[model samples]
Every structure is written in structure tokens, then in C-alpha cells.
Target: MSTLAPPLRTSWHLKLAVLSASLLFLIILATAFAQPAMRQNVQPYLLDLARTNPDNTVSVIVQKNSKDDASLEKEVNRLGGVVTKDLHIINAFAAELPAGQAVNLSTYPGIKWVSYDAPVQKSLLGGLICTDCVSTTLLSNDYDYSINANKVWNNANNSGAWLQGQNVGVAVVDSGVTNNLDLYSKNALLRSRLVAQVKVNTRASNAYDNFGHGTLVSGIIAGNGTLSLGGYIGVAPQANIIGVKVADDQGLASESDVVSGLQWVNDNRDKYNIKVVNLSMNSTQAQSYLVDPLDAACEILWFNKVTVVVSAGNNGADGKPAVFAPANDPFVITVGATNTYDTATPTDDTIAPFSAFGKDETGGVKPDIVAPGINLISTKPGLAVKLALDHPDHLLEANINYMRVAGTSFAAPQVTAAAALLLQSEPNLTPDQVKYRLKATALAKKAKGSWDTRASLKAYDPATMGAGYLDIYAAVTQKKITDSANQGVPVSKLLWSGDSPVNWSSVNWSSVNWSSVNWSSVNWSSVNWSSVNWSSVNWSGDYWGD
Candidate 1:
């Protein structure tokens, strides 16, 4: 009995030792996996910056698990960093620390990511152009007719009532907007539409636009055409404007400032009934939307029902990665520029020369729509006019009241204005619904055949033109759109038939009976492409750009 007892005791101790060893092995394995996650949380550019300038101070976006501002500040202090800004909305902090030290913060407990403080700039390509300086014709501008806004106003539902974006609110987050005569005239209707103005930059004493970009963008969105005497009414002439001044007088904004402005918009959305926000600038750095702080901030606004529109950028001519941050994100409506050929006809409209295009890192096609940005005439801030007058070559054709400008920056506001119009019609529509309707109802550019010179030149592609040009009337009037509130349609389904080489008629437009249809007899133009699910379509090796 004594011998048996001893053996039992030995076996129990052996089991205990084995269990301890196994637990230790698991701990080591967990640490091995955790190290990579920590490394990945740090953006690649930040790591590169650390390696190149270890001792130099760098600005970083430090994300944390806790929302407590005090704790976040303490964490930054522990890492030998100074907190520059507290972005409570995103549970993040902007800090300045030695580049080498910033990398070490990634290993700290509760730290989610440490990204470089990326810079953003206003995206303007060309100075404004004057089409006819001598003429005083009161005709609708080419941009208004190009997007069919005039038709939407004159349609039966509106019956020439000027659907003037009543009660809709649009927030322009850019360089501050000045008190332009077009927006702030004593006319009670136009004056009352400037709902709220907030200056976000520390350097700016007031909300006046010194840089000229924001005023131009705002004019494109909600300008009442007061200066032009109703000859240049914007897409949503009656929409309320919320001026969010994120950039300074120089038209430069940091990632932190932009994020802060977005946060402010989210907070004050209900106050102003701000249903739309226009981001007419682009971040210079091209990071994955999955990890970009700006992209995350933009998504927050989108999920909260604020329809955010961003510029795809003017970097296409550079042949670099064209789609910029925030714009690269799939959720926000990224708009590209299209040239209207100084005429209102749809056939002559071509993709703008400098409009950026490319798939995001997730392979999501971008620049969801294109609008008239070439030589567009809109309200000009007083300072902008002064600068243009100083350099006439920079002016397209400037008058005392308006400036002609071109860029995806201007293009974005057109879409923003369109969004205001849609929201004015259906205020209950979710952000996804608004996006779906716009893309679904967009007009397909007139095909120029296979051997057309434009096709040979590779001027436009799905990535560039998106769901084609903005058709405001069709977007507002479409009755049978698939409500995308639950699930988003893929970009492949919206690709223009002419852009793809595949025979689409053989594919399903609505049903799965691919084998039952007469492929040759199908009318490609008549088929409702919006209702078709092209999930099985392969767009691999498709030409995006240079």
C-alpha cells in the first residue's frame, strides 16, 4: 500500500510539470503573433521615417483602446511625447515625438496604431478660364446643362420651382469661405442660408476665406446665383452652407485638422441639419483606407448619414498612384473631373486631362462619378479675384463677380450639390441610398465605337469616368433603384458596357437564366444594368491608367 501511494504522488507531480510547460509554450506563441500585429499597426511611412530620421521629432497619430482623454495624454507622456491634439471622436491623439520614440509606442499596452501625421492640400489643377468676357448672355452655364440640373428644375415634379435645395445643409471642409456677395448678399433668402461658420485653424482669426478654394467650392454647391442674377444658380441653390474652416489661408491642412473638422460636423450635424459634407482637398499620402485615420473619420460621418463627397485629385497627369486618401475610401462618394468642351452637349464631354484615377488598395474602383470641372464659373472670393487679377494668365476669364476654375476640387462640389438636391427630395434616404441612386441614375457617356480616337488614346476608363457623368434629373427621378441600405453593389456591376470587352447581353441583367436568353438579340442599351448583379464578372488586367 505504501509503495503504490508513492507512485501515485510521482505521477501527479509529473502531470503538473507537463501542464506548466504547455502553458509557457502557449504564452510564447501568443507573443510571437502579437509582435507582428504591433509592427503592422505602425504605418509603413512612419517606420521609414523612423529609420531615416531617428532623432528628429515627428508628428504621429496614436490610437488607443481607452476613450479617456487623461489616460491617452498620460500614455503619450510615458512615451516621451507631447500631445498636440486630442481627437476624442476617433479615440486617438496627435502627438509630436522623436521618430525613434514614436515607433516604440506601438509596443505599449493599449496602443492600436502609430501612424505618421500626413499632410493634405487643396486640390486645384488650373486657374479659372473665361469663356466669353465680352458677352452678357444669361444662358445657363455649361456645367448646369451638362449635369442636366436645368432639366431637373424644369421637370414636372418641380415645374420650374427651382427646387433650390430648400432646407438641405452642406458642410464645406476646406479653406475658409469669405463673405462673397453671391452667398452673403442682403437678399434675405441667400443671406439666411449661411447657417453656421466655424474656424478650425489656430492661425485663422475669422472664418473668411483668404485662399479662394473654399468659396469657389461653396459657390458650386449652394451659391444662389445672386451675383449672376439667376444666370449661374448652383446645383442646390437653396441648400444651407455650413462653413468648416479646416485649412489656413495658405490652403494647407493637416490630417489632424481635417479629422477634427469632420468630428465637429458629426457633432453639430443635427443643429444645422447638415446632410452633406464636401471634402474638396486630398491627402498627399496614399495609404490604405483600412488603416488611414482620415478614411476612418470620413467613414464615421458616412455611417452617421452624412453624405460625404471627396475629390479624386488632379494627379492623373503625374502617372503616379492617383487616388488620394479619404477619396480612396469606398464609402465616401469620390468625384472626378470631366471636361464639358465649352458646350452643354453630352457627346462632347470628355474626361478631364488631370483627373486622377486608380483602384484603392482593396481593389475598390474609385471616383464614383465625374462632373463638369473644366472652366467652371462660380463665385470667387475677393482675395482670389485679386490674386487672379495680379496674374491674368492664371485667370480663365474673371469678372467682378465670378471666376472660372477647373479641378476635381470643383468637380466634388457639383456632386455635393447633387447630393443636397437628392436629400432635399428624400431627406430620409440613408447615405448608401443616396450614393446608390446617384450611381444608378448617372448617364452613360455616348459610345464612340471601338476605333474612335478617344478610345485609342485611352483617355477614359471605368476608374476615371465611374458610373459616367452626373445626371441630376435621372438621379432625382429614378423610381426603381435597389435600396443599398443593407448591402452595397460592387463597382463591377456599374462599369460601362463599352469599357469592358465582355459581351454583357449574354450575361444576366436581372435573372440568373443566362442559358435561356437570346444573347445576340438582347438590346444592350435598353437593359437596366443597375438591376444586374455582375459579381461573377472578372475585371482582372483591366486598364486603369498609366
Candidate 2:
């Protein structure tokens, strides 16, 4: 309810990079310190209230008082502006401000803390080493990269044949970065299409990335080879990466900034033929409004035939039900976390202790699926830069450089990279089709009926793991039209929570030859492939006799 003072005269595009995962981004405080009421002589941080068409205003959420919200709203109204969005607790976009301004934002009333919006840069150096035979060790060191290589070598149409001339494009909408030789050597990282870049301050420019999160995320998705754990590599080693630096070095981003990034991708999705978008950031608050800017952007991407993957969040059991904004949005593919190599135990695919869960205020399951996010390793920015400088291929093993970190953020790019490979295999699949194939064909990491207890092998629960673990080979091979669920095969009863409905409005029995079947007791007449309600329907029965 904070009132905003208007008429700063600078109306730059406000891009708010909202969070979907925890490990992939740097966050910043949204609101900066404004004129402090009842306190004179104390300089307050200034909040940038970017006016979007007067009716919609994106405010940089800073530390402020609840009582002051109303006053702030009044102040904004005075300037012909409205307080459209104020995410008080989760400020991932605040990283764009200068250090002094960022400090002022942290001290405002009721402000717990402000995180800077950091960008995710690509690991160019890693790419250079891996593609060359001399840099084979670059793919050996990291476990996550090993897993990715395994998935790709086994499923990507037999040893990288499908990747020929594809040059799959991925958008890393986090931090800005410069082109380097490591990525250039293997032709893995593409810097040519810098569709757009925005910075809060003109001094640093969009290329500035202090937090180094964006570079890391991009490297995970497409780092060809600069260095290896011993010899590790990214998932889509040959894919082209587009760095969208929405967050500043501090890792903070405003809501508008996030929306602006999405809009940019949506407009340019066709130009680059960008297949997938990986968001590793998260928002603390679950947006209640249907027309939320983040959600709207997701829907736009979905309609434009672009796959959007988001992190479930890192707010598990901290306070409220583990839910994050944009991640919770229905249109976006929400990913949760699981441990790598724990399939034998019930803990396998169980939501990571730090990973967020999905349930609305009314209690509904969230996070459509979970991937390996815990203790996962991937590329780093500084290391990539180092690799480029040394040109590891030309240097000795001692000259190689790379980095590793773990989080749900690290896990998200795996799926994003997988989607890119899937797109390569099935170039005609729509975004929704890709999502369904991902869920439908995912191999169960654990057995059935396994709960909280960490057994050797257990079943994946919809409440926690959702449709099970990611299986690239099966997903690429699985036929959507022949899927048992789509074929009207029998699926067992399942217990689901949330707003899922049981009734169908349209059904296609062509796959089953059920045109002559009775319509009285069966729900065969109203199954809509486009809007299949997963929560309300169970596919377990389809496999029993199929």
C-alpha cells in the first residue's frame, strides 16, 4: 500500500525478472527507499516506479511499513500513477541498483532484506574444450554433465546425428555477457542475436553482471567445453544460447523487468526460432491475481509455441506452503527437485528438503514434475572466462578451467536442455505437446507406494514427484497419439488435490475405435486433448492392461 512519488521523467522499459527456480539467478530488492515519513535528514533509497501505460505501474519493492503502504499509494496517486505490484518479501530484481542504492533499499521499514537481480551468463570456455578430441577430459569431471551426456548420447537419434545443422537456440534471460573464444571454438554458445538488454543504470550497461548467476545457468544449458570437473559437459553441447540480462549484477529484478524479458522473447521467439526458455529464479509470494504480469507473459509464450520451464522454488516448509510466483502459474511447466542416484531409496525424487512445493491457499498440488536439483553440478562464469583466456585446447590440462554449484536452479536447465533435444528430434511438436510428452514418457525413478521413508526403490507420488523422473530416451521414443491415456485405455483411480475437474467436454475415440461404445457411463465423449485435466483424471489404469 505504499504510495509512490511520480514524474522522474525517465521511462525506461521496466523488466522484472521473476523467480521460477532457486539456483539459477541472483535476486535484488524491488522497492528502494523513498522519502521516509516522520524521519527527516535520513536519506532513503529511491524506488523506481516505471509507469506502463499509466493504468499499470511496476514498482521496485523496497523495505517499507504496512502503515506506509497506504501513504505510498497516495503518493503514487498524486503523480498520476497507481501501485500495481508490490512484492514486499521476495525482491529478486533489486540487484540492478548501485551498491549504495541497494543498501538503502534493505533498510526501509518492514523490509526484511533485498536481494539484487543477478544475471546468468553462459560458460563459453567449456564448450570450446568438449567439442575437440583433445578436450575429451572436459566431459569427465562433472556428474550432472555426465548425466546429460548419457541422456543425449543414448536418446538424441544416435550419437549427435539429430543435432546436425539444428543449432538449437535457448534463451537465458538472466544476466548479460560478452562473447568469448571458449564457446566460439566449439560453436556451442551463440552471441550474434543479442535480441535485447536493459540495465537500471547507464553507467554499468547491460553487459555488467556482478553476481555471476546468469552465466552459470547459461553454461549449464549449452557450455560446450572450457573445463570439466575432471571432464564434464553441459546437456545440449551444440545448442545456441541467447543471454537476456534482465537482472543486474546484484541478482535483483523488478516485476516489470521480468515481464519485459518475456515480452522480448515472445516477440522474437519466431525470429530466433528459440525452442526453450529456462528460468531459475523464484518469487516468495504466490500471486493471487489471474492477470499477473508474469503469468500473462507465460501464457503468451505458450501460445507462441515456445516451451517455458521454471523452478518450483527453494522455500520448502520455511513458512507458508512451498509456492513461488510464475512457477505456480498454470501455463508454465513447473519443475521440482530430486536427488541424483537415489532411485533405489524412497528419498529418490522426493522433493528436495530446500525445494518448494505446490498448493494454493486452498491446498492444491503444485510443481508439475521434479528433476535432479539437489547437489547437482554445472558450469560457472568466471571459469568460462578463464577458459577463453587460456584457450585450454592449446594449453596443458593444468590450463583448463570450470566451476560447479548445486541447487534447484542447477536442475532446471537439465529439463530445458532436454526439451531442446526433444525439439530437435520432433521439430514439429508444439509446446504443449512437448510438455505432455515430457510428463507422459518420464521414467519413474522409484517404485510405487513409497512415502517419506527413504527406501532402496519406491514409487513416485503425485503429491511430491508428480509424473516421475525425467527419461530422455523414453520421452523421445514415446508416441503421444499412441499413449494409453490418449487411447482411452483404462487408468486406475488416483487421489489428486486442487481445482481439477472430473468431467470432460469433448472426447476423441478415433484412436480406440470407441465410436460405437456407449456414452452413458463412460466419459469418452468429452476428453479435450488440449485441456486434459491431470488432477481430475488418473492414467495409472491405462498401463494395467494396455
Candidate 3:
């Protein structure tokens, strides 16, 4: 009995020692893994800027590990930073701090990351040629038929309902959308279609479009052709507009204003049923989409189910890579411009000379789709009428409140309006699904005579045209089932990765064979541009150009 007791006691002692060792091993492993989390929370640019100007106060985004406001405020105070605003929606705070102090805040226990609030400028180019056509007549333009928008409106489904983009809301985040006579009328349906207009900038008391850009974009999306008497209708005439005025009177907007506008849209998505957002402007500063704050803000909105459409910029003539921020981001639909040549048939369509194109910084193919933007006549601001009339050579047609304009800015809204029609047909479709559907159903560019021969000595490339022109009827009526779960980078992975100050160098490059985008089947030499009328061609306009 004594021997048995000794053995039992020894066995219990050995079990206790093994349990303690196992617990100690787990503690060591956890500590080793967690040590990397304390290294640095500030982006490299912020650090460099701080070193150069330690005392300069700059706006920053502060992400905290704790949710308690008091704790966050205390931390900010301790770090010599002033809390400018609390963005609780993103679990972060907007603070203004001395550059050096802001960088130091990254060392705090509860801090996650500190990012400089980058500035975002509007990208617009002004160039136009007046069409000699009479104002009293209704001309059939090529863009509507080029994209097949007219067919979508005329076709009847099993339910006898035409895809007119009813009940869908598209948020235009840009210069204020004015109450143009073409946009708003005595018709209750038209009046209510403007839905909600919010001024995000404190500098403006009213939400009127002082800069003519936003009104034109809105008119292109949902203007009900009241002024033209159904001759110049927009792509989705019945879709509602949720105008988010981020840009000021000078057509300038900062990153914060855009972010605030996006946040408001996210919060009020249900109130307005905003399923699509048209970002017709581009940032001058180019950055990797993985680390760009504007791209991050756009991704958040996209993940929440808002279809974001951005202009690919009008920087094509500069010889620099034209794709720039938020458009450079893969998640959003980056649109380029195609000249429909003011005709209904797409046989003469060509890639716009001024429209930007290229692979994004992350190597993603951009300008996911192209649309008719050259000499588009849409609703213009009250002030632009005199400007258009003064420059008769640039005016295509000037009605009481409408003017003709051209830019990649105008091209983006065409896709946005089409997205509204798609959502109206399938409200449950995810943002990824919408993107895939548009790309899959697009009309392949004709290899011959598809581009202006005078501007280029070589053949047209797919890099400029993406998946070709926007095909609204094909995108809406086709019954193809797609699972976009694996396409591009998932927004969820970007949002929840917890890898703040994203190391862009480490991003896994897409293995997609970009060479596969080449169009070798068509004869390029047979194309002749001499048949196209050069006099009526509007070369006077450029998109987002200097």
C-alpha cells in the first residue's frame, strides 16, 4: 500500500508540471505574435512630414483599440492633439495635431493607426465645339443607341415592366446639383426624384451648383428630358438622385469633405435607398489603392453595397499613366470615355483621345468600362448658359437650361445611371455582381477604325477600351448567373485585415494574364478614318485637362 501511494503521488506531480509547461508555451507564443502589433501605427508619409514640420498642425485620422470616447479623448490630449471630429461610424476620430505629436500618438497603447488626411482635388477638363444643329429640333444622338439604353426602355419583360431605373437611388458626390428647370418641374414625380440634397461643406449655406459640373452629371443620370420634350433623355430617367455636395463653389473638395459625404450616404442609405454613387472627379495625387485613404473610404462604402463609379480622369494627353485615385482602386468601377460621333449607330464609335487609361498602381486593369462622353448635351447650370452662348463654336445645342459638355466626368454617370437600371431589376445584387455583369455584357470594341487615326500612328489597344462600350440592354436582359466572390480583392478582407498602414509592397499581385486582353482576331490595317467627318468632330474639349 505504501508503494502504490508513492506511485500515485509521483503521477499527480508529473501531470501538474506538464500542465504548467503547456500554459507557459501558449503565453510565450502569444507574446511573440503580439509584439509586432506595437511597432508603429503611423503611415510613412506622415512620419516624413512630421520630421520636416514638427509643429505644423495637420488633420489626421486616429484609430483606437478601445471604443470608449473618454479614453480616446484622454489619449489625444496626452499626445498634444485636438479632436476635431469623431467618426464613430468607422471607429476612428479626426484630429488636428502638430505633425510631430501626431506621429508620436502611434505609440499609445490603444492606438491602431494614424493617417494624414490627404487632399482630394476635382479632376475636370474643359473643351467643347458647338454643333451647328438647330435647337428647335430633336436630334438622335449616337450615345443612347451606342449603349442600347433606348432598347432597355422599350423592351417588355414577363411582367410587362420596362427597365427604367425606378425606385433606385444614385448618389452624386461632387459639386452641388442646382435645381435646374430640366431636373425639377411641376410634375410631382420629377420634383420628388431629386430626393435629398445635403451640403457637407460648412463654407456653403445652400446646395446650389455654382460650378457647372455636378448639374450636368446629375442631368446625365436622371434628367427626365422635360426640356427637350423626350428627345434628350438620360440613361435612367426614373432613378432618384441623392445629391451629396462635397465640392465647394470653386469646384474644389478635400479628402475630409468627400469622406464625410460618403459617411452620410452610408448612414442614410436606407433613407434614400442609394444603391449607386457616381464619383465623376479624380484625385491629382496618385497612390496605391491598398494604402490610399480615399480608396479605403470608397471600399467601405462599396462593401456596404453601394456601387461606386469613378471617372478614369482626362490625363491621356499628358503621356503619364492616367488612372489616379479612387478610380485607381479596383473595387470601384473606373470608367473611360468613347466618342460615339454624335450618331445613333456604334459603327463609327472610337475611344476618346483625351480619356485616361492604364493599369492601376497595384497592377489592376482599370477603366473597367467605357461610355459616350464626347459632346454630351445634358443639363447645364444657369451660369454656364452664358458661357456656352459666348463661345458659339463650343456650343452644340443650348436650350433654356441645357448645355453641351464633354469629359470623362460625363462618361462616368452613364455607367452610374446604367447601374441604377440594373439594381432596379435586381435589387438584391451585390456590388461585385453588378461590376461583373457590366463587364461581361459589354460590347467588344471593333478592331478596325475604332479610334481616331489622326491622333495615333499605331493600332488601338484593349488597355484603352477595357471590356469595350457599355451595353445597357445586354447587361440588364441577359440571364447569366455569376459568382463574383473570387473576383479581384474582397472588400471584407481589406476592411477586417486589421493591418493598418498597409504594406503595399507585400500585396499579392493578381496572376491574371493581362496579355489575354489583346484583340488579335480583327484586321487593324483595313480601317479607314478618312470616311469620318473631321469638321463636326469636337476636338476642342478635353477631360480633366490643364
Structural similarity to truth (TM-score) of each candidate: 0.60, 0.55, 0.62
TM-score: model 1 vs. ground truth: 0.60
Candidate 3, residues 1-546: lDDT per residue as tens digits?
Answer: 000001112466598766665465345333422454434456555767876776688888776655664576666665556898876644577888777666566656676557677543222223222121111112233476668776675344212236767788899887777765556532453456788889897776677777666777898898767665444678887778888888676666666677678878878888999999988877665556655556666876775688899888888865555677778888899998887654454545788888888896556677898898886777766745333445445433224456667788899999999999998988888888899888877777342222212222122357887777788887877646454522546332234344232333355434332222111211222322232222111211235321
lDDT by residue for model 1 (190-306), tens:
456777889887766678777677787888887767665454667777678899988766655666677678878988988999999998877665555655556666766775678
The count of residue-pair clashes in candidate 3 stands at 8
lDDT of 2 by residue, 1-546 (tens): 322232333334422212221111111122322333212111111222211121232233332324234443343344343344554322211223334333433343543323222222223455332232222211332234223234444322222233321467787766554443333435333543233344532333456444456665666666655443223456666666767766655455655566567767766777777889887776554454243445545645654567888777666645345565566665566777765432112233355666666664334466666667654334445533432343323222222234334466766777787788888888777666777777765545443222212132244667766566665555665554332221332211110111332222254433222212211222222322222111111101000000
Ranking by lDDT: 3, 1, 2
Please, what is the whole-model Cα lDDT of each candidate in the order they appear? 0.65, 0.48, 0.66
Cα shift from native, residue 312, model 2 (Å): 0.7
